[model samples]
Target chain A: MRALSKKWVALLGVLPALALVAFACGGEGEEGETFKIGVMESLTGPGETYGTVAVQAKQMAVDEINAGGGINGRMLELIIEDSKCNAQDAITAYNKLTDVDDVKIILGTSCSGAMLGAAPLAEEEGVILFSGLATNPDIANAGDYIFRTSLSDALLGVDTGNVLWADGIRNLVTITEATDYAEGVRRTTVEQFQKRGGQVVGEERYPSDTTDFRTQLTKLFNENPDALHVAAQAEFAGGTIIKQARELGYDGPIYGEVVAIGTTALEVAGEAATGTKAIITDLDPANAKGQEVLTNFRNRYDYVTLPWYLGSAYDNVYIAAECLKQTDDDQDADGFRDCLYGITWSGAIGDDYSFDQDGEVVGLANVVVEVLPLAERTQDNQGYRVLGSAPAE
Target chain B: MELPIIGDIIRLSRDPKDSLRLSRSNLEFWVNLLIISWAVAFAIWQGVGFAITVGTVFAIWAILSVSLNLVVGFTGLLSVAHIGFFGIGAYAMAILTSDAAYEQLRTEAIPTLGWPFFAALPVSVGVAGLVAVVVGIAFNRFRDDIYVLVSFGFAVIAFNVFLNWRSLTRGAFGIHEIERPAIGGWVFDGELEFLALVLVSLAVVILIAWFLMTSSFGRVLTAIREDEQATEVFGYQVTHYKLAIWVISAMMAGLAGGLFGSWTTFVDPNSFVLMESILLVSIVILGGLATIWGSLLGAMAFVLLEEGMRFLPFLPSEFVGQGRQVVLGILLVVLMLFRPQGLVGRYKL
Candidate 1:
């Protein structure tokens, strides 16, 4: 009984500390006076590069809007939470944002898994969950409330297949990381490529976080295909796969998805990254609005060299703010969602921004880019040279 | 002056030997009863939304932790592949109740066998038990350290199967829109309803564990854990005892997994990883090995800690993402240094 009492005492001692902590962090804006928006991102995990840059881009948009005297004289308060690129963490973050912070609309989720995991919850709660960069094909019909600013993996895969076939690469060998994002792209690419009278000679899959791809690459190279299609979620692994394939004496062109069109691939693969082509959704660097956003992003975050999700994230904030402006009641999630669906605004990346019935970005164009060697790459170039653009439809 | 049941419970709590037995006590039993009652009442009063949802998850974890304790705590097997059974159960329930399966069956013009949650639950548990029997037979030749390695290896193999088996498991896209447990025209769809179901399941599992641990069979298992060679000399078939308990524990984990999948209405490979198995073990060790009550306490504490650490004051916004894990790590180290036997454990690791 004494021991039991002591245990009770210990538990009692811990409760106060928890209460204090909760009290300290519990700060909400004045009710109904400001437009409260929740933001979820992988702020500290492997996907931190995209997440941190996305936050910066959103902040930049928010700053611009506030400087223009706010959204119809009402302030926009952004409550950001870190998802850590894990599904469980994403759920916890979502619950905290909805229950504790009491935010109506959420903009998130750079990672596909995080976005998909939280989609059901958002739908159940009748809140809008808009993603800036999640590209998994499953997310298209995840929930009515779920939407993304990025193009779907299915469209990107079709475009990639077209690009490969146009380049006279008839036979292909593919290596994909075992994830929703990578596998979705790989499956669709194979399907579309096969429909266009091209054959996938060999295909290999490796688990996520696997740095060693020699065994899979060796098996793939044995097919002696015209090109190797690498679908990886992490840019570093994509670059490493290309370098390892080169080391194994495969001199054919390498193809990748949007995830590979970054400095990580160039720096990690070195000279081997040269001539590697990828499909990306960012605007042309030469475009005025694109160059302005990129310049501002570069100045703000000196470490981020690539405009990966910067333009999309910047555009998402502006789009959400625009939707909030049209709503008579800022607290009405349904009204905000309806307004978002009806929007057709021009943004930095495209001449017109709109969403289809499925809430995916409509008329989003995919640009094919190639990696240039270090000596040929410019300061603002980040090693990727745009080759051509494909219709997103 | 004490009432009949109340007097008996007090007497039980006062005696150390009686307390060590699996019987209920006045203080401990009432405390747990009150906690559970408070949780239900709180959910009801608070409208059964987010907190109840989180509580339902905690209940499922508690069940898994208790089930794992049967192997790691009572029997000292140190099985690390428990989540493999968890995955199997979740996948089984998912496949049985999934609308995706109906779509596939329609393509073949075959009638859909979209079984209800209750029907799938028992099948999932049975499947996990059968798999455990196979694994136990394969690894019965090995002992101790080798058993641990084989169990760890099993988890890796199971995870890879869950990942690459795109035809059945749908790979990383996951099986979505799983039907909740329902009767004729009545579904346990609300958070409070699910919480009630989970609590009932937890109570049954705890009662069964208590009954088993108090029996002579449980004593023999403990004797084997203390000294296997000595127990073998006493005419006990140690391998059979270990294998039986392993299968039973695995089935319990499967049952918990089924409940979890049904409640979440989704199942994916990411939920059943090696890290989750490790967390289950930590819950058992942290709560108190060799004590069923400890498993419950450990699970609740772990969940609360994970959620509560997010609210820590004065943490820089940048560090908030990783700070919860850091705080948990520091707490675990301090606990290990101070109370290696665990917070409520009767035995030391």
Candidate 2:
């Protein structure tokens, strides 16, 4: 009788653990509670500068939404987590938000690798994870629970290669950085560029943190190709390419992907990167609506955040809040996941986001931008004018 | 709490004495593994990519962790270089299975000479084993703490090779798209079936490992661990025993390397970095040292704890990306401070 009583005591003690599971599973939106949206961005790392502005942009959107009486009269709360651009770290941030906070909609994540780990976990747990800057096409159909805002590495590769080929630049020097994302750009660009009949004369891969590109620049100097294609989304690499190309006295046209977002390229490369060609999805330099967004974001965030990809992170929270407002029922991870496909709001980028079959934005066009002379560029309430509207079409 | 649902008839007749160890009418790990294998086969039949990914990871880790136990727990020979051996194994299989973008690498790097996956698997592991033997012979002279530092050096050196060896490893980009086994015109397809195969392979390796640990040589190792000087007095060659165990451990790491390649379908310096070796040590520490059963139990516990923790966000953010490592660090410190014996504690051979 005594032993049986002790066993009962132990079993009763374990009830608390079972209760935890119960607690974790509970907490769907009640009749009165505000719908919570999670903003998971890298608050630290190489992307922290962008993340800082993104947080402001996110706040601007949320505050405006709340001021307008919010969705269905329930105020939307923005819960933010800093993923720090690491996968395991992002998972930790995600769990803290999803498991305990019970936020159904996750607005994340900056890094592709971090998103890869967090996305699967989110899908498994039925948390509808929407990423802002994850550009890998493989991730779009990764799981039914995953969705993202940016175009793929493959798409930009095709776009850039075809554009260069059309410009009659056959001789090219391709330099890539040593990271999965950078290497991915390298692989796709090389393949696409070759397909477009562009001759890659000199090919070399630089270290991710290389400051001096004199050797590679010198190699390129000798080849003197028609165009120099640098495949890296990093600023330091972009800056080095600009500075080194000028130093090595190779006066060829330069083109790169999102590497132009960093102002360091202009600062370091001086007038060299001005004429450098870059691809983007949005331009706020001359467009009225775009200029207004860039100014408000800068004022609210205390920094200018103008990249189209960065705005999407801000817009992720707004879309989720809007979707939750439209739906009457709340016990719906799959429904909410489905609801995300039904967005049509003219937010940050001045475009109504229409999610396609893969939950990617349809007609998401990439614009070719030329870096202008610093003297000619106008500094406004936002920042500097980066690109003109595709040479006035 | 859950009783084994299946019975193991083969284990009983083949080894009547061993049968006494397990409860009658209850399945042991082997039987459980057999059932799991069937389930995995079904999963693979349904889809190859997912199954194979999980299988490759499980099998690699299982072999890697258990083989590590031979040195860390049973032999009391602390090494942080098991990851180095893992890298060697992976590089070997990668170069063998794939057509050589085949460039020259650092010191530990081998050309693999375009061997088939099967041929590369053993040869690579053998290379690891040989390296372990040579290293063991040299390091055997040092007693206690010095041996650990030396092993640590080996792991670091191995990492350097993977990191700086540009032509072969492509530096940080790593070796990608190593082909999987194509049996009967069906490329493994990398599904749950592959994961099951890896799991089955893990279970089988554990069983074989159990047999090895139970053998007479294992008894000598136990004696040496308890007191090397005393074992020498008892007419046993302690150095030879150490070398043999190290060789086996190295080979197992090699096998794990092959399995990891199949799962990720990619191998890089990152996969076999020294941190992985540290994780293997932590697995034994948390589960229990010197206990074969503990190694298996430890792996399951590690996986479960890691996955479970992902569900709890109330835990400190310091416990985030580095949280698992932080928790393991704290747990290890506490374990060493108090229950130095580990969770299951040490066991007899």
Best by the lDDT measure: 1
TM-score of each: 0.90, 0.63
Overall lDDT per candidate, in order of appearance: 0.78, 0.64
Instruction: List, residue by residue over B224-298, the lDDT tens digit for candidate 2.
Output: 778899999988888888888888888888877776664444555545556678888877776566776566656
Regions of model 2 farther than 4 Å from truth: A1-32, A36-69, A75-106, A113-129, A140-146, A162-168, A206-217, A241-251, A260-275, A286-306, A333-342, A370-393, B1-66, B72-349
Tens-place lDDT digits, model 1, residues B1-349: 1123344456667985765453433344443443444345434433345577668778899999989998888988888999999998988887788764424321111123578999999998999999999998887777789978999999988888877787777777777667798888899877688889999999888988888899999999899779989999999999999989999988998898888777666666777889889888888998778888788877876776666565676565545666667877777676566557765676886
- DockQ, 0 to 1 scale, candidate 2: 0.10
lDDT of 1 at A302: 69
lDDT per residue, candidate 2, A231-319, as tens digits? Answer: 77577678678878877777778888766535655566666776777765664444565566666776754555445765776667677
Would you list the clashing residue pairs of candidate 1?
none
- lDDT (Cα, tens digit) per residue for candidate 1, span A172-251: 99999887788878877887788889999999888878898899899988898999999998888888998999999889
Chain A TM-scores, per candidate, are 0.91, 0.85
